[model samples]
Target: MKDRHWRTRYRVGAYEVWGTSLDSEERRRNAPHAEPADFGLYLDERWHGEEDARTSHFVYWPTLEAPVERALLIARIKEAAAALRDGATVEVACFGGHGRTGTVLCCLDVILRGTTAREALERIRREYCRYAVGSAGLENFLLNDTGDLVTPEPLRAGEGR
Candidate 1:
């Protein structure tokens, strides 16, 4: 809500992914799909305002530290995917939707769609837009050979799988 400059939406697999560019009002107006159940992922700590919240399809806040943790990120994406499959529009946003948000988006692509982290990051930039992840550290993190892309195993609340 704080004057989103650039916003664009596009389909990624079975989900729609996008973010505001920066200081572009026009993009914000026509950005998100006009659905009530959309889910948004806010990367930054800034307040996006009450009106933005009310009108948003759905929103998720994952306040990550400077270097994002893989386990936490995977959990958040799982949550987002669940929401999206349940008839909600989803948005993942950081300050510029580049560094933090972009990194997470890449992870989501690999984890959900079976792309390698490196390949997924590259695909995100090539397909979504350049300047997606601004930090070299974040880019490295996404592409690191950190085992078999650790993801949360499905948990049954009251019973064993």
Candidate 2:
């Protein structure tokens, strides 16, 4: 069997999700016979690569910030869900494989398992990464049913986005 760069793998109901950093895709692409994810969901505003459109998607999301596009986010989440329903292994990734990555994973739980926002957060934290959903704003967004896309107010000044 080939090695997988997945930092975390967990099942939400019948859906199998693999979580990793952007570097994982690069490594997998370079390695001989490394098993690639059937569908890749890349969440980072930094670098966008030319991954196959049929199998990969790149969403522009900043680090430590809640997604500002509600429709887009939900659409991507639905795409992941659909791919999983088709028996495809979906890999969600960000830069560090924690905050944004975790947030999306939790959202998937909400969609796939019908879990509440809190429930999704807890489950992802326990099963995927303890550091998942690293911001209260992101949590609030999810708890609020992932509504409008407004930038959350920073707790203090000089906080980087």
Candidate 3:
């Protein structure tokens, strides 16, 4: 909490994904004439802040809980991934940046890397923060609910099912 606003949580493709907490973002916003922080596109997963202009999309996700609307969350994560692929710096965060923030970051990883939810969770924990996906239930939800987020591998020439 010591004036640190953002941290590079992990990478998706060639983009460096950043993470922050609502408190930190508020700090950045309230400071007078602070250079606009390069939080290019925000995938806000906090329970509040629906009116935040910087938020590309807001999901009312509670701390240490699984996303209530899995489909919508996946779609938003896809949008964020698309923005990242197009050279935008994407930031994902919730109230604390460890629970819900980490959950969404895992989903983004699933979509971008075609990895299973469990695999994405492992990578996020290893690369971002060890305490990420902060609870057992959240971990289970990430493992089970994100089955739809995995991108299937494309068949190459002469390959048949």
Best by TM-score: 2
User: Which tens-of-lDDT digit does each residue in 1-161 have in candidate 2?
Assistant: 12223446878898788777655564456534456678888888643663322487878777576676667877888888889989888888777677777888888887777777788888887877777777887777677865322224567876775
The regions of model 2 sitting more than 4 angstroms off are 1-7, 23-32, 50-54, 147-161
Compose the digit string of candidate 1's lDDT tens values, residues 1-161: 33233446645577766554333556456546544225565655453651232323223334433354555555666677666567666666665556666776776677557777777778877876676665676766667743445565788788675
**Ten consecutive residues with minimal summed lDDT in candidate 3?**
34-43
- The Cα RMSD of model 2 versus the native structure comes to 10.9
* Clashes by residue pair, model 3: none
| Best model number under lDDT | 2
Model 2 lDDT-worst window of ten:
45-54
lDDT of 3 by residue, 62-160 (tens): 446676667777777777888777766677766666777788788887777777787788888888887788898789888877777656679999998
- Stretch of 10 with least lDDT, candidate 1: 50-59
Q: What TM-score does each of the candidates earn?
A: 0.67, 0.76, 0.74
lDDT of 3 at 65: 63
Residue-level lDDT for 71 in candidate 3: 73
